[model samples]
Target: MGWLSAGDGYEVALVEGRVAARATAGRAAGRQLKSLPKAVREHPEVDRLRRLAEWLDRHAAACVTQVDTWMVSSLPVPTGLLARVWPDEAWQSALRDLVVVGEDPQEPGFLRDATDGGELRLVNLDGETVRLSPATVTLPHPVLLPDLEDLREFAAELGVTQRVEQIHRATWLRPEGLAEKATEVREFAGGSYDSRFALAARATALGYRVSGGYASCRVRDAGRGVEASVWIGEPYWDGDTETGALSWSDENGRTLRAVEVGPVAWSEGMRMAAALHAGRTVEEGRTA
Candidate 1:
């Protein structure tokens, strides 16, 4: 909900409030960049951050302005650890005000935004809709870091203790060193790289055909055994936004089973694949 200025620091300003300054990513460039931190600049997972930062620099002024209290389209911070910074009072206040005047935009494949604007709105090229709800807060990109302390604090202040656990329900899938393989599976699985690839590789290695969402020997399953299917799409419901759920069918076109697998990272997904290859299921209905 704030903008990092072009100067030697970051400047964050809320609506109708004074702009505040503190050393920011700019400060990191000098001391931190004396040598790129392996975890950030050198790690394969962080290449996107490096690439995005380069793109943002090319369009500095335009990019910075995207940081409204409700919506920011550009990738300012890395989707990983950089997003885990302690939530300062400014951000908490802005988010608190945001929860009151708007409903969360939970539509899949549609960009949702919330800010100090009159109300919470979900807009697409078709039109826009607004609602008043205090039990709502727009879902931001998941904080990729493992630690959830800061996020817990924010949720507590918002009086949404459930959100603390909800954060664990989302997943991120970035396949390092397997970019080409990941790309192939993502396309086949309806952009579900994590679940599909993780499942497919393990199944194929164990002898099965790679189908739309599952690796099975038969396209249809009768009543003999459970014929399953997984749905891959962004999930949003009841103000909770996690990755999609996995669905199964009985070949009679009747729903058989479905289970949710909270958010999963690519690295974690791969581990699940390894488990499947080892003849172990990951304690979830979805593949990985």
Candidate 2:
């Protein structure tokens, strides 16, 4: 952004997300100051720039969140929508380098650019840039990508770095032989925290919601909604608490048996459970 004149002999602008200043008539004219000068510290132009920077930060975060949701759900997004939003710097940063699957299905590519002319430029696994105008594209979850390892290797060679986690997001797979009638999985049970508040805080920090005594994640799988939860104790409790069994419930709140959970739901549920467990306090060789 171009600098704006704050007062006399000085101009101010947002630099690296903060208000910065430079002299206009002195020896240091046209050179950025190491810190904001007191003369313009409370200036209206500087305040406006600071607010704009803050708003831009929030906008960037929102873009990453929306893109992350689309990837996690493996939902198809309209190509036109991508092209429309591609002009936005925030959206572009979040969507770039994501693995996108178009009509071909078998040919997954790294999203490179989206043009206003309704074309998408992508770098395929074969290390070639290709243009496509598929009606829609899917930013597939890493677990659903058949050639995940290959894509990861290619991304490394291409020096790909995505602002939002897609290819490198943690994932867990449903194991074979879960008891048919098991309504909850105890795989991540018995994680202890200093207090219920601490456990709930960890869950929230990890981007899960706290409701009642459970830290939960709601996801749509196979056209149905399922909520995965791990017990974190009652919200009002301040005493020590232990992470409880992980479970899944339908949108209507009916518990689902292990065998009844869909693949995506199962994987997402396990991912949540594993994440909560990873934060459990470890005491020597025993879990605290």
Quick one: best TM-score, which candidate?
2
lDDT of 1 by residue, 237-269 (tens): 122111223333444545432221112223223
Poorest lDDT segment (10 consecutive residues) of candidate 1: 69-78
Candidate 2 regions exceeding 4 Å error are: 284-288
lDDT of each: 0.33, 0.89
lDDT of 1 at 22: 34
CA shift of 52, model 2, Å: 0.5
Clashing pairs in 1: 70-114, 102-120, 169-263, 170-263, 171-263, 171-264
Residue pairs clashing, model 2? none
Identify the runs in model 1 with alpha carbons over 4 angstroms from their true place.
1-138, 141-149, 156-159, 163-166, 173-175, 179-288
